[model samples]
Target: MTTPRIVSLVPSLTEAVAHSLPGALVGATDWCTHPASLDVERIGGTKNPKVERIVALAPDLVVANEEENREPDLDALRAAGLDVLVTEVRTLPQAVAELDRVLTACGLTTRPRWLDEAEAAWDAVPAPERRRTAVVPIWRRPWMVLGRDTFAGDLLSRLGYDHVHAGHPERYPRVPLDELRAAAPDVVVLPDEPYRFSAEDGPDAFPGLPCAPVSGRHLTWYGPSLAEAPAVLTTALRAALD
Candidate 1:
């Protein structure tokens, strides 16, 4: 049986598929930057993928995430008669299961070592003695934060942090900075993507709170990065508090 040619619109999925089924990826979005040595056709950004170009690539399948991609773009891909596999991952367990499903769809019969390692890494994490309240801001200009049912919120919960806005209806809600400051979170968790919240940039926003500036990829992405996220994130969060 011939291996299916794939195009990944999700960055994390691109890395997962690339690591699991080398050379199977024919195209990927510009933001798919893991495995820095990856050589494939650059499609476009996640939200604005070039449908016509993807169809031109004639991939056997195109993988996308419900959160990272827009509905109309997916509909357009389907309209073009292309087989598109859409994945929705909102938690750690879902991420693992989806990775397996995606790898299987890509014709991988055996589970990749990275996937097993990632699962084991998360499983080995001991539950925190006490949970801290946090507010995770994804963007700055309008000040949007992780709200209800977010993958990042789930990861933070596992690491013993509860998002202040977890009960909010919107997945990403724009809250006024004054209101965020008023929440009086024990710590302000900032990931460096969607917005590049560095030491010099993000900490000043929260006057007295400890700011844990972590890798956005580790906090948000669900791929090989998961294997090391616990240790990396723990270290960053602890450093900020200590």
Candidate 2:
């Protein structure tokens, strides 16, 4: 079978597909910003993709993630007779496996070299000895935190930061600022996406606590970025701890 033309709604997946097959991606959501110069038709945001524009592009497949995209949008694309490939990756292993699945399903007979490098990168990681307790907030106003079964939480755990709310029932639950600060975690891990938490904005929330500002992509994204996540995230975590 010929390689399917894809429209990606997930930014990480967009980069993966674009990096692997280059021109295979013909359309992507506005949020798919990797490859810096990716030349694809814009189909709006992940949650609010332009179904008509996607259909107009006549792509063979539209890619999305279960957590980052809405079911109604996937249903809409499927209803339009466009094949939609949805992936569910909440862990590093799942990320690697799903990338292989998506690539193979898209017609690549072999896995990409970056996939190997990404796997090797994580495989080389040894468990950090000085594990610290941390509160990782993804959003501020109303304050949602990384809870159970999250990619970011797993990454933190591997990097030796125990998430204070890892047992919360919701994957991301809103905790009042007072409650979060009162938790008295060793550090506050702030990612620069979802809410773009920065040194000035997020660290101020917890005056005395160390705030480790890191890239949201390295923490959450599971594509090409995964190759460098271990080193990049470790540096930030260590810097904050120091």
lDDT, candidate 2, 168-227, per-residue tens: 999999999999999999989999999999898655789888888999999999899999
Question: Can you list the residue pairs that collide in candidate 1?
Answer: none
Give the winner by TM-score: 1
Check candidate 2 and list the clashing pairs.
none
TM-score of each: 0.98, 0.97
Runs with alpha carbons beyond 4 Å of true place in candidate 2: 1-3
